[model samples]
Target: MLLHESQLAQGVFNLTWKVEMSGTIETGHVKWFNDEKGYGFISRDNGQDDVFVHFRSINSTANRKTLQEGQRVEFKVIKGPKGLQAEEVTAI
Candidate 1:
């Protein structure tokens, strides 16, 4: 669902759904990755705190899935258990 600024002004703060209301997608570079552990962090281009990324969150079409350091990517943000995390990630 799309989240317009006006909608947020109306107090739409539901946590059950992944919201991309702002109509903004983010791009970032992989800061580090552990192929064995299947987890890593991405340094957002906006200069925000690095976002955590998991192997399962990647959207890849290749037979082998792996992210290398300095790889550029686009992703959506979700409120994960620990905090904000990258989801629906795809290599850019």
Candidate 2:
């Protein structure tokens, strides 16, 4: 959710506008992933902002926990320290 300065200013004064997460399970495609870094962003199918996905969140049966680019995945959305993050991610 990209916010303009005007909207941020208005929120500061009026305290109305805000970003909210539904905390629901969602499906998306892996936009890009760095296997070495063990982190990536998923392009949500719902057209929302991309959610950050950590390797730890990946549900893998193998030893390596990594996601490939363009892979389809299902995950739960959570409000992370930086922004929206993916949790309990599983390949679909």
Q: Which residue pairs in model 1 clash with each other?
A: 3-21
Per-candidate TM vs. native? 0.73, 0.75
Q: Which stretches of candidate 1 lie over 4 Å from their true place?
A: 1-23
Residue range 1-92, candidate 2, lDDT tens digits: 99999988876853332234666789999999999999999999999899999998899998999999999999988776577888899999
Error of 1 at 35 (Å): 0.5
lDDT of 1 by residue, 1-92 (tens): 88789877555444444444334689999999899999999999999888889998899988767799999999888776566788888998
* Candidate of highest lDDT: 2
lDDT by candidate, in order shown = 0.83, 0.87
**Model 2 compared with the native: what TM-score?**
0.75
